[model samples]
Target: MLIALFQILDFLLRIVGWVIIGQVIISWLFAFNVLNASSSGVRGFAEALERITAPLYRPIRKILPDFGGIDFSPLVLLLLIQILRMLLGGLAVELTYSDA
Candidate 1:
């Protein structure tokens, strides 16, 4: 059903949001030298996170002007994700009500 599909999408969006948060934290840890990127496990985890987030961040990074070292792509991506979720949720509600 459309509702079930919407639920699945919402869950996925939440998971991706968490992944982005984790990626940001991990990057900070690495930068602060609290986490060693040279370690195999650490490197693997970092690489995986990069792989998951890179696709979403790439286009935003291209459009936004670089601010020296500060990357705003993640924030932009999160905003976009929230907007998509709101649009999908509204669509789901409208569909449900129209069926009544």
Candidate 2:
């Protein structure tokens, strides 16, 4: 039962990490003019990514100092996700040993 719960949480963290990566890639494409944001489909996809990631970035943005136009919030959030995953893994190990 505990392992199942840990697996679910790990899956969720992995999904969030992928979403962050996707948003970063999309932003890069837009910046380089590789993607046409003028098209409805592209615009909608970018907007959807933004909507999903904005909330995650908000608090991090508050704590991080601005670097002119460069945003590090996504990087910070990714690090946070990694840290949480590590903690979860440690807890799982500890719990499993306790049960044994």
Clashing pairs for model 2 are none
Candidate number of the best lDDT? 2
State the TM-score for model 1: 0.96
Residue 95, candidate 1: alpha-carbon lDDT: 99
Q: Report how far off residue 87 is in candidate 2 (Å).
A: 0.3
Q: Write the per-residue lDDT of candidate 2 for residues 9-75, one digit (tens) a residue.
A: 9999999999999999999999999999899999899999999999999999999998999999999
Cα-based lDDT for every prediction: 0.94, 0.97
Question: Predicted candidate 1: what Cα RMSD to the true structure?
Answer: 0.8
Q: After superposition, which runs of candidate 2 have C-alpha atoms over 4 Å from their true positions?
A: none
RMSD of each: 0.8, 0.5
Write down the lDDT that model 1 would get.
Answer: 0.94
32, model 2: CA deviation in Å?
A: 1.0
